[model samples]
Target: MKKILIFSASIGNGHNQTAKAMQESLGEQGYSSMIIDTLEYVSPTFHKILLESYMNLLRLSPKMWGKIYHNSERSRLIEINVLMLLANKLKKLINSVKPDAFIATHPFASCMLSVLKGRNNWSIPIYTIITDFTIHPSWINHHIDYYFIAHEQLKYLIDIYREDPEKFKAMGIPIMKKFREPLDKEKLRETFGLKNNQKCILLSGGGLGLGSMEKVLDGLNNIDLPLKTFVLTGKNQKLFRKVSKHTYRHEVVPLPFIDNVHEYLHVADLIVTKSGGLTTAEVLSKQVPMIVHNPLPGQEERNSHFLLNNGCAVHATVSEQLIYFIRELLYNPIKVDHMKQMAKRIAKPNAAEDIARFIMEDMASKAVSKVPLGGE
Candidate 1:
């Protein structure tokens, strides 16, 4: 068994989800893997501040965050300084873990790992998984051995950024195995008390439930189609309570923090969601057409654009537009089917397993191994 260290950040659930997917995949492949929240491990105070500030920006002023994200992309000096600041901490962790390889699901972790590898000239293989459809300059590090991205377009984009195409692989973002497995759609609809004949539309606010669920649901209710609407409020208790009280012409099933999201996704004819990486990947895997709504300004906006450009999804920035799009998609089944077809074409259902196998094969082919699994 080989020991693999996976570093992820908690800015949102997407990065952590990608990290966990890889960890699970590696475990099944008989590898000893550890997942670390890099920010928390390096500095708890910094992690708290970074996480809270990000959430606050997303909740209050997303435009400001967007501006910051764009500006940061050009700040290579600043990025390097941040990396240098964390290099000592990362070095300490690497020395302690003594893992055979490193995998990063977050850009920050990738930068830190790149710095450590460059400074120490470590031979351990470093893989960076871009958990979004777009690539940011911050994610590009010359020291990284391989880059796993969502699509071929992203690979081309990264090539322009890094000037190295050989290091990139268009491995779709890793999702949980359950998402790839088939579920009985009719059984799921029955379990949720939805009508078998009606079309089921799922509205999700990602894991934090961090969007305007009430307004979106209200907009969807205005559509005249006979449909079953499922609202996943995530951890938003207030939104759940408000949705639970509301009655609509269509059946509205209000749920909070569900673990069986894949089942709901399986039964859904279309999904209205914010374009988080993991959620979008899961929806694509389920081959459900998407109406992207209120994507967070930076990566999510890019994710939405990718889906739209690829013909797999539609975008609705407000509730009214959401209603119109839903009406259009529902009334136009052919269009929905087309979107689903595009989704299926791009979906990487076996990404996690593929990544695990690639890492194993690459490690075995290397002349010098770093650390043995479960050994000193």
Candidate 2:
């Protein structure tokens, strides 16, 4: 079996989840793949400092983070510095792993590997997945062999940069294999102990402490509809405890980090979530309409914009808007059905399988033809 090395970052679970999805798909295609958290592996201290600083900034002062995010279009100081720090460690890892190709779910991984491959004359491929609705400049570079984007509309990013358009595969973002399969909603509801008579509203903060779920839950208490709500306070014990202890008008169930996210999604009539790329993709794949809460500046805002423009989600700027959207969507089945249709129309449910097949076929053909590997 051909060996594949995938590099991911821990900025959020999205990056690692993206990498794992690809790994699982590739494994089904008879490939040996492994995922590495490059950020933590390269330097644990730097990883902690970076993640903490980023989380704090987004929580405490999001405008400052937004300014830095936008200014990065004209400058790659952070990416460059990360690339520099990752170069030596990544080189050692690659030499040790000796894989046939490299895959990156994070920009830092791709940028560093692209440069290192050219400089060291490594005969391996480097593929990247841009896991967002919008393509940031940091993810754009000349040396990557191929890019898998979330949508065809984002092809303009490649076209405007004078890169070969064929280098991009707009195959949608790869999601878990389980998400692509058909699920029984009734069974899912039974598994999760959901009430059949009440409306099901699933609220998630996108696996990170990114949104105001407590405030949203408090507002939800005022909704007069009969409801069963599942609050996914993922990996946040404090938040989970608080939400679990809090009283509400309806049955509010709190869940910690769960392995069966797809199941909860399948049983939800409506979803209120922060607009992270992975969660959005998962929600869309399940054909559930969304109410996205106060998105953080930068990519989250961009993701929310894409969802709003696509007609599958409501962008709520504050608690009131979020509550209003929830009430409206809950009572209006016609609008909810329309949004679900739109989501189904745009959802790439076969993204993981298609991407796996494409990579496998491309690699086999390249090997048969003996073409030089690892270049743009």
lDDT of 2 by residue, 142-195 (tens): 578788889987777776766788889999888999997888988877777776
Model 1, residue 67: C-alpha shift (Å): 0.9
Give every collision pair in model 1: none
TM-score of each model, in listed order: 0.93, 0.93
Question: Candidate 2: minimum summed lDDT over ten consecutive residues — where?
Answer: 367-376
For 79-105, candidate 1 gives per-residue lDDT tens digits of 577667865676666787788999999
Q: Give lDDT for model 1.
A: 0.84
Best by lDDT: 1
Candidate 2 residue spans exceeding 4 A from truth:
79-82, 206-212, 368-376
